[model samples]
Target: MTTFSRRKALALAGAVALATGLAAATPVLAQDCEKVDLTFTFWGSVNEKNDIENAVKNWNTNNPCIQVKPMHIPATGTNYVQKLTTMIASNTAPDIGYLGENQAFQWATEGKILDLSPYMGETPDQQYIKSTIYKAGDTLMGTGLATGVMLIYYNKDVFDAAGVPYPPAKADEAWTWQQFVDNAKLLTKDRSGKNATDPAFDPNAIDTFGVTLPSWWGGWYPYVMSNGGQFANEDGTALTLNSPEAVEALQGFQDLIYVDHVMPNPTQTSSLPTGDVLMQSRKVAMSMDGMWRVTDFAKLGINWGVGVLPKWKTAETVVLSVPKVIFSQTKHPKEAYEFYKYISDPAQVGLFKSGLWAPHEKAYFTEPDLLKTWVQAEGSAYPPEAMDAIVDYTLNHAPQQAPVYQLKNIGQIMSEAVEPNIQQIMNNKATAQDAMDKAVATAQPMMQGRW
Candidate 1:
């Protein structure tokens, strides 16, 4: 029943607003006397930490009534969910926190996250892009967390040097999967100057790879999506990993290695850094990657050009976005809702958007130069058309797949069971079909017990 006033919350986020030209301190009224404290938990590196702290400072400066503290938990891998779940069980949960697109829905279904439908109503949903939020059921309006969009990144200098054409600035001309594979085959070469398809090509003596696929869950999303595979049924109850579409998708992904022979083997790939795949000595011509590539890898002296992900049956890619959820156990739901409204304002949203995190709102997409300016202000790492391609790809082709789990413990169980299978497929130790089949068999027991 304790509420942090809206005006106070605005003052609290002043630093964030100021950075985006909305930072003026708001007047604090006498009614702002409540001793309110809220904790925000999220995962990030030092630079990302600074960006978030700056946002929190802005909020504190403008709002004198509420005291908000930010907590950084190093949840490398699935530890984020593990630690947070422990906190919730003990009723020591933060008032508001970030949740992944899928994990958010699982938490929400467990009654851990507050339902914002009453708070959001039609106006907020109107501004929301359907692809950003996860849905639990067909008619359920909002039950999920954040979304991320996938993109193709090509080394422009490498392309130009190899005499291959660059990806177009817009999605309308984006290459299909076949074109992408052909380009990869063309760019892949050994020291003796043989492409992947050349009879003279030698895999053992290869010096450059056509592309790099991260051996993680992220890689599977595009493969399955591009091949017209659905990870789960529309209703989110049954597993769909054995479908022909999923098998086809897996075959396509595996083809990058076993069939096309353009990608590096899993052993060599495990040594790669998070975003610097293009920085390898045996040059990488392209990478199926995330938008974070611009902010994370642009400064590495690689001439990278981004394009919409190559299409298969349809031009689709997976998007990962986070949502800030209010705890159902919070003492001040109204005040928390007020904070949500205050921080999500366009000006504040713009600051977060500029910092490599995509905003959930739609207005940010229309500003063609917004993404380019944000990344360039730090340094000119990506090519000029990077933002154009990302925005075009996300707006036109990104579709939302629910990230929710069927059972309460499903988050931990699925992460544990699936990551290794992903590793197995990426390493070619097992076929995508074989790996996924084992994964389903393992997870089915857990889901049945929980759902």
Candidate 2:
């Protein structure tokens, strides 16, 4: 046998993957698929476990020889990456798995995962609202099994109780920043029934907040982008949070908690746990978060409503992607690819309507039936008007990229230069200008290591 170094083997495998897997009409590799039990690893709750099991059962019913077992990784954040990396290095990694945006870029670049070029089955249709589903460049890093977008989820009961109309669903018709603030003022009420706009309204006595966004950068990133902020150069090489637009965006959120006091203080939310509970319990009337929360809200029977994000200088929100990648060290690439394909298949449109995900395919967005399959649910899902706006307006209007994700060592960069300073801004430890300046000062030096 010819000796092949590991990296050479990696490159050769990628080439082979591209060669044998045709992008169209490619037959499954004719092999004994049932005798093989491929273990797929992922992270999530029991609900995810159930979803994967359903998908596996659907695929396994016909292919008895090839069985796919969903393995619960029981890990999160850095721990997830570390455990999976160790598994890969030890040649004991599961056959296929989920790769977050940071890892998809980091690992696929290093050839630690399979490129699915040949097995993709078709040239992707690009007219969908959330186009560029995965930023794989020339490599088939993996298909994002589901695409999710940032939008506002408000409690319909809260809106009705406050006598406020629903927020706009269309991006073009999005509320201006001031209008959003004004609406929030109207929605917020204190224990004594005073609104935020009332001079007698005490922030300390707020019973229901007007709005609240997730604490993470994902929630606030769009604020900067919509305001024409360039937080960094197109490539994530340097920090620009100190720029006027970026600072203004950061301050805009800070003002909500401190100056305007329309938002709940971050320190006070430890009891609530999630945005869903905040809405369900009526502590917050409007919650800005990813569409995934629709699952939990729907299950809880909350009278929830969906709407596009409130635009600042322009209408935009960040798109969240979590792609599926095959480990290069897998012994059963064909069986693994089959399982990956089954779960990642665009035709599994039912996942969308269930509230766990949104469509990652152009057809689902363009074709009405496909869109309805994934989008229309009686409750805890987007209503008809909101569904149309998401498909026709928000999906197309959301930004092409998440500014903060344009980085190498994204976790490290964010930890050192971003989150802490952002905490300062949010907690009122520092003004947006000071917090951003500090973040830039710390993070600028680390950009030297970026890809």
Candidate 3:
């Protein structure tokens, strides 16, 4: 439960002492009788780190023969990758670690990570959500540590003050893009108490924005898919960012800031706090964000509600997670897999109750009792409507694999082409079509085929 800074120093010292102790002890007659040490590396918030450390402590206490050390890496995204890569290069990779979906595939292809197929068994997909299982051809790389899906989080007080009806919870009853925009307009008000629909409404002096459209892929990708767009073709051999469907969806989001004026622009949004804070303070009426925000919203004590995302041709969302994988260089594969299984289980970890993660196993969705263990659990913090808005929608309406899971070299593509051009489009410096066309040109050559 210690902070990362203190935990890092203590872990290193304990590892050194453990190594010395084992080296000085009399040689054990059987390999099974000898003590085994395994390291698990991961990156996340302080709460998540504490949760994992507690799990490791419990495992170590219960299993004296196989002691697991928790290695806390307090970095995420590219920085995490950089540190992990340095460890691998120095031949000091942990037995297992949390890896981004894109990097998991890339590493699996390079044989840097172990194929977990033998441990998970044939038809691993039968146990886990098919989308969350990472593979290179037939070789299973790893499974998601947990699953996450996007949802429309709105401030009930804001909608009530504007006399606007709440958005629908079920996918079948989802609002159309136009209807969503119309509602957003009604909720958007200027400092003079004029809604966006009012002719006298001043955009320059807005008191509250109707929405905060996410510029990140997790926020916008669902809309693109719902509009019948694909980031790449099924084979993942080419970039399809310039497709008509993609152009339309991206433009529609941009229009929210420019033409509709219901959303804040890049500069304006940068000055605002995160989505959860935005809703709590009523600075924005609604936000399209990951369900993980439930933890923050619950603590903020905001009067909030969950709703299915608005649809274009279909109501769709993306489910994703960072996978925990066993390294190829591990000296104790058996012990590593054991700890991996222990930590990945929702029932074993405390993350589910904090609303930071969802169960990755298919049974959690299909089995009523298992579903209630997390969704309806006392400290879960999920809104009442989450059963329909998130769980049901994800199980029935959402695509199994998000673009990040399907596309190869996605991290590079996002950095080199997608992110930069998308920012330009959001800034109103370029049109969606023009920006995507430019992005596609740069990303096409980087496509190395999907996993």
Candidate 4:
């Protein structure tokens, strides 16, 4: 794959996305399903395809009557969407597929996906992360097979060399907003041994930046939440991103590049896979990114330390997980739910073992021995001890967030109206308040609709 394609793909790596304006999935004509041979499909690399296929094999061993056929959407020019949209319209969609959690809910609003609640057994004591597995208004849309946690990653070598203590692993020990920024300033340095705080330091022609802040909402949401800002009112009905608190949070983040001059500018991080690369090369000393990076970062072999994001009003970060969904058109609803349950069985992906996913099942976070299964997996890249604080912070402290998923068509609003302004802030062309005001002006009417 081209680097650009890889970057595009990785952008959708932890958080997810898709388009609007595609006609709603058509109502399927009645069809018999005496044989009950269901189709399961998704878009992924060969290895991911194999892992999914193998998971299905395990499910098939017990359920002999319901045979599942796996389908891999070919990688060609947004081919996954092309095929899925066509299939849904033509009444040939798979019984189950990876309809990114956010997109699936939107399609479900348009009558495309099956609500698995009826087929669900009574809620078990141990279950998936409540925020991710449940839908807006309490509808059970699909099941999450994996989890992603946003974390601040620091280069251990850089922290040691600079004599700056590593950011704390525990939430209680987190640095405050100003403290975090100040530490970032200290980490930033030029080739001539000058930090960002130095009188002679140059913002331009910098050797290494302290951190890299992302304009993407997933990355920005934490800062906003930490500052007691709200992107939307409860139940996802209103835009509050222009609120004073949010504006200040956004300004603080933009200042990392523009005012404090501690972080890389948007142009510098435009290269593929963003944060991990800068840290690996030591071009950046620290980065704010999701833990799903372990699958890739482990290979870089850089000595990195995980740190807890600082609190302002209080600690907060983005909480989201991609889900596997069942199509409403599936004639075999029972069989589809059965297979969907198996695929989303949490243990299937082994992502936690690989350090690319955090624990979604409550047990993994609450019980030490149970949690060790993945954290201490052989050759694991994640530091079991260092990650405990993050896990505690995620489970007990981090608020369950809606992001672009709970509210239908919000992703479109974010892309068309919100992202440009975020870019403007990063480019130092507009203040966060001004940019957000313009964004609210542009997006408010569209978002007012229940779509």
Tens digits of per-residue lDDT, candidate 3, 1-451, equal: 1224323433454211111011111222244677898888888766567767887887776677778888888774578888889999999988988987768877888888998877666643655554777877766876777787888989999999999989899999999999999999999999999999999999998889999878989878888899999998878888897999989999999999999889999999878888778888888999988876666676778799989999999998888788779999999997777777666655555567677778776656766555655777667878889999978887888864777777778889988989999999999999999999999999988988776
lDDT (CA) per prediction? 0.62, 0.71, 0.79, 0.69
TM-score winner: 3
- Top candidate (lDDT): 3
Provide the lowest-lDDT 10-residue window in model 2.
15-24
Q: List clashing residue pairs in candidate 3.
A: none
Whole-structure CA lDDT of model 3: 0.79
The alpha-carbon deviation from the true structure for residue 55 of candidate 3, after best TM-score superposition, in angstroms, is 3.7
TM-score pick, better of 3 and 4: 3
- How many angstroms is residue 243 displaced in model 3 relative to the true structure, after the best TM-score fit? 1.9
Q: After superposition, how far is residue 57 of candidate 1 from its true place, in Å?
A: 2.3
Deviation (Å) of 258 in candidate 1: 3.0
Query: What C-alpha lDDT, on a 0 to 100 scale, does residue 365 get in candidate 1?
Result: 63
Model 2, residue 370: displacement in angstroms? 2.8
lDDT of 2 by residue, 349-384 (tens): 245666777756555565443444467533325565
Clash tally, candidates in order:
23, 8, 0, 0
Q: Tell me the TM-score of each prediction against the true structure.
A: 0.78, 0.85, 0.87, 0.80
